[model samples]
Target: MTRRVPARDVVVFTRLFATMIGAGLPLVQSLNILGRQTEHRGFRRVIRGMVRDVESGETLSGAMGRHRRVFSELSVSMVAAGEAAGALDTILGRLADFLEQHGALARKVRAALIYPAMIFAVTVPAVAILLVFVIPTFESMFASAGVPLPAPTRLVIAASAVVQGYWWALLGAVPLPALAVRRALGTSRGRLFMDRLMLSVPILGGLLRRAAVSRFTRTLGTLVASGVSILQGLEVTARTAGNRVIHDAVMSSRAAIERGETIARPLEESGVFTPMVVRMVEVGEQTGALDEMLTRVADFYEQEVDTALEALIAMVEPAMIVVLGVVVGGMIVAMYLPIFEMITAV
Candidate 1:
């Protein structure tokens, strides 16, 4: 019965917790204050439970581990590392920063797609209304006038008749494909295939790749900076990676590192990381600055994602408008051709 907390809310909570702890407030006291102030009932319940557990002598990270639905593996691992190092405030601050940056990236992507999605949402139903109602009325008028309909007009009317006849099937068609896709993604192979396919998609593929790399590097770097071992960091990063391809690549790299192979070499072999990233990682390893280098890579790719999203939005907005216009205009032209021809004859 627990509600899913939004990433933004989690980020805010983490920031406030870090600030309160840094200001010398006790952990239990901070949780109590935050829990009372939390507007989300589910999140409040989670906070209160953590408070009770903390008061019962459980470590903060251990208490959070019990609510895996709210606190991710990354969060728990970071907190555990913080507690071990006696730098819980610093780790919580870093966690908050990571969450905020990740949420910002997601928001940008969603924002870029919003206009095109809205256009399609409005256009589809408008076209359907024309097809289902408006076109049929015109067809009856033409039929009663005993006028021979033009080929285009006849085609449109036939389409309208089909739509009217198969309305239920048409409605079912929407969710059935989505349900099938959801089911497919539930399987490991299906998820891997889809993730690979996503990387090959035109325009969006590059964006997705950069975004995935940004996420991978950022998560790994943050974990490493917070004192998580490379292997453990990679494992956590892989598990949380939204794309299967990235996840597999990180796991492969982790396995290689376990065998004493360099991280860069395995990542390069995985074909997910760019040559620049590989070279940077190699240099970082040699200089003992792997965490710093990874952080740099994350920063670069996050900027790249921003630029790519902007370019994509600019291209998609016009393209969607043109497509919508062409579809609706074509149908209108098709329906009106017979009426125009009859008027011209008279």
Candidate 2:
């Protein structure tokens, strides 16, 4: 099923609209052109609405603000900043880059998780079918021999019997835990707990943390560079932080900033940020180039995230294959062991 204005569509729209505006087309004209030429039904409607709003003398930011789902608060605020500074084209281009970069990072992480999930999804039913059906056909022949079955054969037979008897219970079990977890995740406390749990996992947790840090820094840096305040940037960052733990940390940082603490101080205290990130923010605050420094931190963390994810994918791919092999191959071998023994005796 098609989504309601997928992110890739927004990225393409931002880049193309930025190009049109950079070429000196009027805002309304650019929107009109994009609205007509766009293929996505939902986004095209959004663009048409924007064009009408702009025609009614609403500012571009104000026009975009009406479509918050399609245009993030970060984008809306950046557009406002660009409008104030008379640099709409530049801000749009920068926003496009941020969207594209963040999207790419997200896709990498998503692919890493999805690969293993897909393997399990396909393999589980196949194994279940073998146990419930194919294995039983060999059971009677093995029993009629009145010979002691090997341990592996016994184990397989037992499992096959359990599945045949308790298949409904096993099926009901899978969704019960999933629904409970989904319910838990719908709560604020549960979300925080789960997010924290995810961030504490070994290699995967570190990769997730780095990705979150990269997203936080890059988003705030882009906003600051486009002339948004740290307070405002933090608010936007918190709202868009995806993870509840990071969101709370950012909100706490905002509260600290309100109390005259340096931006880095509260973040450092949050225990989520690494010392390197804290130091970079400190230096940026001291040097009055906080935006540039944040950009640098984001750049470093982004590269780190990419490298870590690549390594993770490399490790996980073969590991998943091995798991699949062990589950299916090992079961088949186990079931055939008694036959192999009988043939050897003959």
lDDT values, one for every candidate: 0.93, 0.90
Candidates' TM-scores?
Answer: 0.97, 0.95
* Worst lDDT 10-window in candidate 2: 1-10
Segments in model 1 whose C-alpha atoms lie over 4 Å from true places: none
Any residue pairs clashing in model 1, and if so which? none
Error of 2 at 112 (Å): 2.6
Candidate 1, residues 228-337, lDDT tens digits: the string is: 99999999999999999989888988999899998888788878789999999899889999989999999999999999999999899899989998889989998888
What lDDT, from 0 to 1, does candidate 1 have?
Answer: 0.93
For candidate 2, what is the lDDT? 0.90
Clash count, candidate 2: 0
The residue pairs that clash in candidate 2, if any, are none
